[model samples]
Target chain A: MEIPNVADKWTSGVNEVTIGATKDKGGSRQKTITVGGSKCIPFMDFEGNPGHKPVIAMDVYDIPPDDWTETLTRPFADVINDPAQWAKKCVEQYGADLICLKLDGIHPDKGNKSAEDAVKTVKSILAAVGVPLIIWGCEHDEKDNEVMPKVSQAARGENCLLGIVSQDNYKTLTATCLADGHSIITMAPVDINIGKQINILVSEMDFPLNRIVMFQSTGALGYGLEYSYSIQERERLAALTGDKMMSMPVICDVGHEAWRSKEAKSNDNDVPQWGPREERGPMWETITATSLLQSGVDIIRMNHPRSVAAVKKCIDRLY
Target chain B: MISIGERINGMFKDVREAIKNKDPKAVQELAIKQTEAGASFLDVNVGTATADPAGAMKWLIEVIQDTVKTPIAIDSQKFDIIKAGLSVIKNEVLINSSKGDPEELDKYMPLAKEYNASLICLTMDKCGIPQDVERRMEIAMKIVEKAVEHEYELSKVYIDPVLFPINVDQKQPALMFDIFNQIKMISDPPPHRNVGLSNFSQGTKEKRLLARIFLTMGISYGLDAAVMDVLDKDLMDAAITAEIIMNQHVYSDSYLTACRK
Candidate 1:
């Protein structure tokens, strides 16, 4: 199809502000990473607005522990006990471009690691990991809201995902993220209407959209993946074809579902012969992540080092 | 008055001679030219009264799709022809029409759902073209309801209170305007309003100019999008004005010019 001349529909990004002005530019860092300033979708320059292509951020966590698989859990075993050390290994050894710290173990109920403990952990990880970091809260909304503010405040200017802002619990999360001066992940279930509504809500609050990434929640492979794929495709098609409001580049969190699903993470006493666990596991992830990428997923939160490697290789292939 | 560009169909001898000669370079050039000229949709009906209408419609649809990306409103009464044309196109589909016939709509409107197609519902029924806007809206509403029932957006369905001659009676133009306004009021975001743009100027010397004036007025209301000629520059110029004046386009909309160029 001939690309329409109406390519430059809108622009939603801006040049990032450096946290501490360096000596040369007023802050202390040897260099500053400026993220966000795209006028178009990832590579759709024909559409006029040349959107900035999203960069990959590898997942890390504070207080790592027990449930690690041999292939994955084994590789990071040395530093799994420390948040700071683990983040360094992820960036130095695993080719991570950015580090995402999932503060899973600090939730009130889950980790019971107080907001103070969470803050200390965030600061330590930031020092240990040179790359820009993204922070994700544990599953419980209340605990996340309680703890994220402190984390955001501690990491002020370092720039991180204000964990998650969901449909039901966005108000507090949004305010915390806004107050602390961090970008946010605008999460939505795999539905276009709901996805768009959340963005509108976030926009209403006047948050800069370029810093906001739309996470179309992942559904496990062979488990309504097609439905999710279709929605993402339609959303992308609508945006690219000229719905200005919906043209924001999309984010897909494949790792969350790849590990959550039985097929991608299970070893077997119950399921059928799905082949060797190692190949089967990463295969499920790589394929799911790749499928979403093809359907216009600009950013992906991935797990499984091997799958991340594979997904990165593929991303390089396309771009 | 929905003005279907009755120019591209192979049923017309010049079009057939141009198309059958494998002259896509020309077929496409002409279609895009018409689309730019002012065709709301370049109607590509490729059939004669005796031919297999479906096959011809599909064939012509393929050619036009290859030539340009503008939505082509299928001009045919036969359901299968409309369906065939609907299937082959990649852009939005604007079915020229189906009047008061429920059975025909049942067999065909679903094709719209299958393809995300739009339509121009001719306001004729078992009785015939209603002489008034109220009745025109009544039939247009039926089409709207059926379209909604089939999961199509009302905005996608253009209700044509099909225009008659202004000379036979100048009342028809007013009736069309009333139909345009009435359909505009059908809902909060009323269904898009349009007409066979040429219908208002039937047999009139100022046929082309009249179509533009009617279209310019249609824009004053909440009318969005239209179907018209792709071969006439004057009409195309009117379209640019309609879009700009209606606030549909912000500043520079030269694609409207490029479509003709």
Candidate 2:
């Protein structure tokens, strides 16, 4: 008996989006990175076009990350205090395709860093690294509304990927990104409907659809990962069937979510039966990222150079 | 959903007058209006209003093509008329349609291949429209087999179960729904299921309401395309909402606007 073929024929593909800018494109970066444009589900190259290989954006904080576990912080200990040095270490040593600058310190409870301080940090990081940047807001709506526009202006012609406007508070960042020539990230919380709804809300402001990226707030390995996984899978299916609202490239905060889990951050004494903290932490982060990759995520915001290396190896073999 | 706007057919008053007078205004307006109303393909039929249907089809195709870039479905029972319309088309086209009988497939399938047009095949053979689910399923399987033999891409083939008016044969709609579910199993990446949606509510007092309800039900049964009124807001809303509920489209507060966009 002969075997039958059961390959799916998809009508559409995820929209391709490029971040960063080179000199001719008006940014100082040496190169830019593009993601999305998959005609099939991830790694199903035999069936159709699995457009670009998934890329990684390593996280760098606006202020030193005092809360990160020792295992997570050891890799960048020498440059931990300087945002620019930390970003450079990520790019030169770790092989990150992009640098995601999280403005966590600007929040009132964090450091209450001024708009000028945030701009200075963004400029220094851009000066230190040649790769394109992802400038994420501090997530305090009022503070983000105040400081992100100035930071957006500081990188105006560089064409960075600026983030994370949800349905209720998209106007400020959206208008600023529009003026700065940056792609915007639209976020929803583990809900596919709101994921698409935020994209619609952002695009309604005359921001082009192709310039948008989607982030469904991530859930770590043992923390509602299935919810995140299923939603990502559904979004990919929707994109394959030509739903424009759900077709933007997806980004997940693997590093942030993975580290937040107790299994990843606990001290050796805290989880003695779970094995050494070194291997356990990186494995948790790596497994979270690599698992989500199967659901067609285009860019993963990761931490820990070890997990990044492991996930990169996995991607290399699969693609 | 692939909506084939049914307003351009000569059986309608405006289209009949447009065909007789060779007036491009009425036909072009409907073409533009239907395109705005989200018709994926405009169905062009020079129904018995003209003495020379082939010439009328050619003229209609030219005018509609000039107005909008939406694909045209060359709709006519006569092979010669469909051929005339195909000759002048400037973009992608669909042949709507050929009967499920092998002889009809032998004639129309080659033309569809040559023109690179999607083909809609009705599941009614020379014995006529099947009244029972079993007979319709048999004819539908034959159509799929013939399509495979011809090496036609199954994704481009649309299998229509041939809906009859609910008032005329109340049982046929239920039978057609069963065929809709079964047709999907005939192939991987199954041939798109379509219907002449207005046919289900013909001559009814509540024409729009019946058509909308039936269309919503058909969508749940895996019907992906239809030949219906794109100009009817309520019907279009129901189709969009059904697709969202099916998870085919991602939902938003302005989903109706988003789907059309």
Which numbered prediction scores highest in lDDT against the true structure?
2
Given the true complex, what DockQ would model 2 score?
0.72
Those runs of model 2 whose alpha carbons end farther than 4 Å from true positions after fitting are none
Report the CAPRI category for model 1.
incorrect
Encode model 1's per-residue lDDT on A83-163: one tens digit a residue: 788888877887666677788787665567888888888888777766667788885887887888888788776556665
Q: List the DockQ of the predictions in order.
A: 0.02, 0.72
True contacts kept of each: 0.00, 0.70
Candidate 1 lDDT by residue in tens digits, B171-234: 7776666677678777644677766666567688988888778777776664455555546667
How much is the lDDT of residue A66 in candidate 1? 48
The candidate maximizing DockQ is 2
Locate the minimum summed-lDDT window of 10 residues in model 2 chain A.
A2-11
Tens-digit lDDT string for candidate 2 (B1-261): 889999999999989999899889999999999999999999999999699999999999999998999999999989999899999988999999999999999998888998999999998987888888888888888888888899888888999989999999997887777788998888876899999999889999999999999999988988899999999989998999999899777787889889987
Residue A267 lDDT (model 1): 72
Q: Indicate the docking level reached by candidate 2.
A: medium
lDDT measured at residue B2 in model 2 versus the true structure, 0 to 100: 88
